[model samples]
Target: MKLRQLASECDEGPCPTVWTIDEDAEHVLVQGFKVEDEEALATMKMPEHETTVRTPMALLKRVAREHLT
Candidate 1:
């Protein structure tokens, strides 16, 4: 699948970013800091194929305003 960058918080290196699937605008791909908190992670049951990341609320709002809207 192709990807189009929607927004990024960094210029160089790994940072919270959002991407849109070129083939489907209804869904988005996210890049964020890896969540390694054992206590927090243990609170939920996630399938082996799925994982989680952490991002800021401001970034999410920006995505909603610019893309989702």
Candidate 2:
């Protein structure tokens, strides 16, 4: 399976991570900064692994659907 890019990162280090989506929208890879420190943010290239969350898109849709009704 191939994953597609839904979002992009900053030009340099310690930027908001990119969001990605697959063809079926079943899986989602969310990324971003873990901490908010002026000095540390400047030196980091990406968000910490613990900060990112990968989940199923279908589950999200289902929850939304249920909530709407």
Candidate 3:
């Protein structure tokens, strides 16, 4: 997706928030924001990471299987 479109969808929650993405001719930039306690923020600066995972549907299936009888 376009960078602006991706960035606009970010929101605050129990998870990290995506802030913005700047797409360049050679590379794409990813930015994010997160809420944290003062101590955590002081030590870590921003609690964002460069990681990815499977879709929520796949995650849900895994969780359900783990808890199933």
Badly placed stretches (over 4 Å) of model 2 are 12-14, 23-27, 35-69
| lDDT for 9 (candidate 2) | 43
Every candidate's lDDT: 0.87, 0.48, 0.38
Candidate 3 structure quality by residue, lDDT tens digits, 20-40: 245454443333343345665
Clashes of each: 0, 1, 0
Residue by residue across 15-41, what tens digits does model 2's lDDT show? Answer: 344333556565555554345565655
Worst 10 residues of 1 by lDDT: 38-47
Q: Per TM-score, what order, best first?
A: 1, 2, 3
Best-fitting candidate, scored by lDDT: 1
Model 1 misplaced regions, further than 4 Å = none
As a TM-score, model 2 comes out at: 0.29
RMSD of each: 1.3, 10.2, 10.8
Better of 1 and 3 by lDDT: 1
lDDT of 2 at 58: 55
TM values, all candidates: 0.86, 0.29, 0.23
Give one digit per residue, the lDDT tens place, for model 1 in 1-40: 9998888887888789999998896889889989888887
- The positional error of residue 21 in candidate 3, measured at the CA in angstroms, is 4.7
